[model samples]
Target: MPDTAASSTHLTLLDDLLKRALAHGADAADAVMIRSDSVGASWRMGKAEDLERSESTDVGLRVIRGKKQAVVATTDLNPAGFDELAERAIAMAKVSPDDDYCGLADPALYATDLQDLDLDDHPDQGAERLIARAREAEEAALAVKGVKQSEGGSASVGRTTMALAIRGEGARFEASYSASSHSVSCSVIAEDGNGAMERDYDFSSARHFEDLDSPADVGRRAAENTVRRVGARKMGSGKMPIVYDPRVSGGLVGHLSQAVNGASVARGTSFLKEKMGQKIFADGIRIVDDPLRQRGLRSRAVDGEGVAVRRLNLIDDGVLQSWILDTSTARQLGLETTGHAGRGTGGPPSPGPTNLYMEAGRLSVDDLIADIQEGFYVVELIGMGVNYVTGDYSRGAAGFWIENGRIAHPVSEMTVAGNLKDMFRQITPASDLTFRYGVNAPTLRIDGMTVAGA
Candidate 1:
């Protein structure tokens, strides 16, 4: 049982520790404390199989003296342990390299008006309850006719609190988030006894349990998806239009986003380097990275480096607008930080996007497909083969064959290859956009992709 009251007290203690670190030896200090609890349950063969519940807290201290800086973290939060951690961090900072850019963020850049977003409010669902839900989902999937084996079904709940404090600057912020997820997967042996096809469906709800999809719904969808792939075959190789379902399109967008990070740009590993203000995509394509999306999984008032977050237009009407940036990478490139820093206690902060999404187009998925005579509607991809520097893109894909504006048959064991530069310029998005994850996009169609199949 986790006590919210105790968590709040611990957060205050962490703030006090930051002040103490600055007083002890560090010219500046920042502290972060995170407490998280999670419950997970899995079911197989229509019965509860695995159940897990865990709670943990981690505290990190970053000390800076001029250009020298060091970070130390520990799961121990006891009074003596906390004091020792601060001392160790200060001592480590003494021997660190003097990089002129390494220091706490300027006080002027700190966020002041923090929003009261309730990210951790959820009904209490015990381990038994989660196991029951998992069993129900598994049973529902097994009930579908022709379903041969259930891979597994699961339900999970998680709660997390994050607190940060910067000394002297007197900036502090705390936020919490709660989430629940349910997933089911099933495999069906084809009637021809030649192959087995597996598919999965998952639904995740944040902030409230009522937002979650029903276990039966997840199970039924998993079964339906598996059945549809029972007779999958290979198609002949050729250049054709490729339609990507929303789930697959999101991943494709993620790869592109990674290539636009300031770190990649500074390291000369991104193909988008020096392409700012240039046309990078089709005329209708637009992409935005918004950190203020209400109840968004990645939404935060301040970035990891304590900079206020804001919406950024990475691409507007096909033109490259800006690259995602963190403090260090931004300074390296002589650009301002874009409030995209993502930090963990284990490593230095890195640039990242929050709630990155592609702007939806006006055409529906069906309407987008109607104009294509032959294509592949990609549902999933396997293996990463994208080259950020050269912009060469190739991936193993599985999907359904689209013929005459309708999905005709399932296809598998194919490779789709194209250059990122050309792919971005030729891609088109459908209007059926759904916000299911931190990064989202609508179904997208790419013209003239080389499909390598039998």
Candidate 2:
């Protein structure tokens, strides 16, 4: 929960807005309010480059008349505009085309109790502290051996308060929650003095500032990564196993989530549309979406639609189990809402995963790649060359070459291509999973990928 007084005030405003909608002949209505504040600082070459702060309050209201719906948003908080906003929404709904699936969550499905997830931990660490953090990171990076120059270091702190209210049949639903984030990032260039140079970056983000990695550590990591990529060359084209480091392996899991989104499934735009209850991954693979994780980057007690949310095993023992779904998409697909709704002031709610991750596998990273005579250990991916409709995948890649079961040298200007269905079936995860991002996975090895070098 956020500040009790603030939450109460936002809820009251939303409730009043909903009442106005109902009074304007809307059958049902819902409203959401978001308040956010953030501060950021950037440093380069021992000097502060920039420091900035922002604050905003925005709201969205949706009204439904029979099967038609309309959504409106505003940054104006004056109560005097509530009547016009409601009236505009009601008029739009009256003239809008019917959408059989448009409506609020069922009253019975609304989350009644808000649980404390320990998401807020931002204190009044002012601009001076932020600048100090950024400067420390940049200075540390420049201290690393083989690190030639600094790109920049940045630190940011942010807090958001969200409230949702729904008008139901003789019942009213309202909920409020708050979260805070702190992050530090450093990017630098490393050179071998033979004109070989490469750039890399590292960052740490957490709900609590205490949980974030120290500025020095982040800078050192960024420098080390950049140094390793110096003197990079290209590996010749071949079809072999491709190993994805933990940092980039999460993308594979994210692709799976997108394929299982109810919107795509309903529209037949996902290659996995027919894969429900089928073995989509290797045996023993499990993927989970948990919105209730205490300190997770995307944790939430309830979904954006004011529906109760729980952890879901999206994949259980390699079998596809559930689609990521919001209310409208679930209705269109003739299934119940999976409570994966994500909302923004400018658009209607849509399905998305929160705190999604694949469970770690049995083998260590060293053991997982022990037998690979030739492979690509991918560290970075570029371009969005994925075709969700066909599951065909291709991407520009840069990483190290694995030769004779060891990382040999840095490689660049490469392409990795394969169908996702085949790649998913060949995935072998390692026991190196870490919860450092919204979507996470262990280091993964996928066999039979086409690796081409320029």
Candidate 3:
């Protein structure tokens, strides 16, 4: 049962896969094995709505023949299927189009410093605990005076074991022992005098159950946000200082992440493609990616290619310093890999950021907004109207209006538009940064954005 639940046997299978690929007319190959177990529950209106549990074990093989490459994935763990899997991958590679930049990372560049990131929290949080947590979240949300109904409250626990194996200059193997996650969320609806309704939600997640915010706190926050949005009115259109709450402000940095992604830059599809080594943000702005943060949601010791991953200052003092790169994209640009390769079970590695965040400035959220006389403080954004290719930005937004340097009234049905190229340059971050998501930023105040409304 221990072996079934989790095992190091995948390491042996990786070697077997690589050997079979070489025997089947392949020059090189890599394998990835993933095993996952998860359980979840949802509670609504004081009753359990559903209980769910699942387990899946899957493996993928990628083969290279000269300049051609192919990938195949399967769930059949029967050792009998691996040989056929390798043969089929090689056959596909034989007819595949040649990609000049496709190849394994240089053997000399493999990560040697294995760091324990404390990613997994053991003693499995059982199904009963998950359901109980869900019930607590729902009851707490419903307890709020103005909250009319609970959209739903949910709790989940999941664990994953991952291994990567490759045959390149020589054989190499690395495996993520395990990663576990716990999450709880609640949503509530509130009604205004005229029966108009508004809904809001909040959630907390962590690698360890103990790190999650109290279920009551999550529920109360959801209720408070929903009630506050009731009967929101529209604001006038104008170009003004736009403030971003930490929740949605991270999106601004998210756009920056996409702009600096190596794949997009290599394909000539990014707005900042030619802006390398140039000042992209305000002089005080700094952006970083850290892959070794203990308990971080996106933390990892090594990238998909087993390249040594480390923290990088992607944007240092406003200058674009690095492109998130994997071996493939780095080669295409005639540069060295930056160890930013991210992969999945069915696709080639892609360059992406992990635990990306912006450094905070020496200003509180209130202090950051104190200077704004007439501005929009965004709490919610709807729709995807961003165009990274041209740096154009437009989005549906709702939040509060800052009047005389204070958040005054709830506002909705407004549209905010600007060019990201300008947004980044004018953004000033507050000193309230928190690492709560894959991409995080503090409350930010951006100057000169067009807010359109009544």
Q: What is the C-alpha lDDT of each candidate?
A: 0.78, 0.93, 0.88
Give lDDT tens digits, candidate 2, residues 1-454: 5578888999999988998999999988888999999999999998999999999999999888999989999999999999999999988888999999988887778887867899998567599999999999998899989999999999999999999888955557888888999999999998776887899999999999889999999998999899899989987898999999988999999999999999999999999999999998989999999999997899999888989999999999999999999999999999999999998877779999999999999999999889999999999999999999999999999999998899999999999999999999999999999999999999999999999996
State the weakest 10-residue window (summed lDDT) of model 3: 1-10
TM-score of each: 0.93, 0.99, 0.97
After superposition, the stretches of candidate 1 with alpha carbons farther than 4 Å from their true spots are 1-8, 168-192
Q: Mind giving the per-residue lDDT tens digits that candidate 3 earns over 274-324?
A: 999999898978999999899999998889988889999999999999998
- Full candidate order by TM-score, most accurate first: 2, 3, 1
* Per-prediction tally of clashes: 1, 0, 0
Name the runs in model 2 displaced over 4 angstroms.
none
Model 1 lDDT tens row, 120-157: 45557588878877777777777877677877778888
For model 3, the local distance difference test gives 0.88
> What value does the lDDT take at residue 286 in candidate 3?
93
Best by TM-score: 2
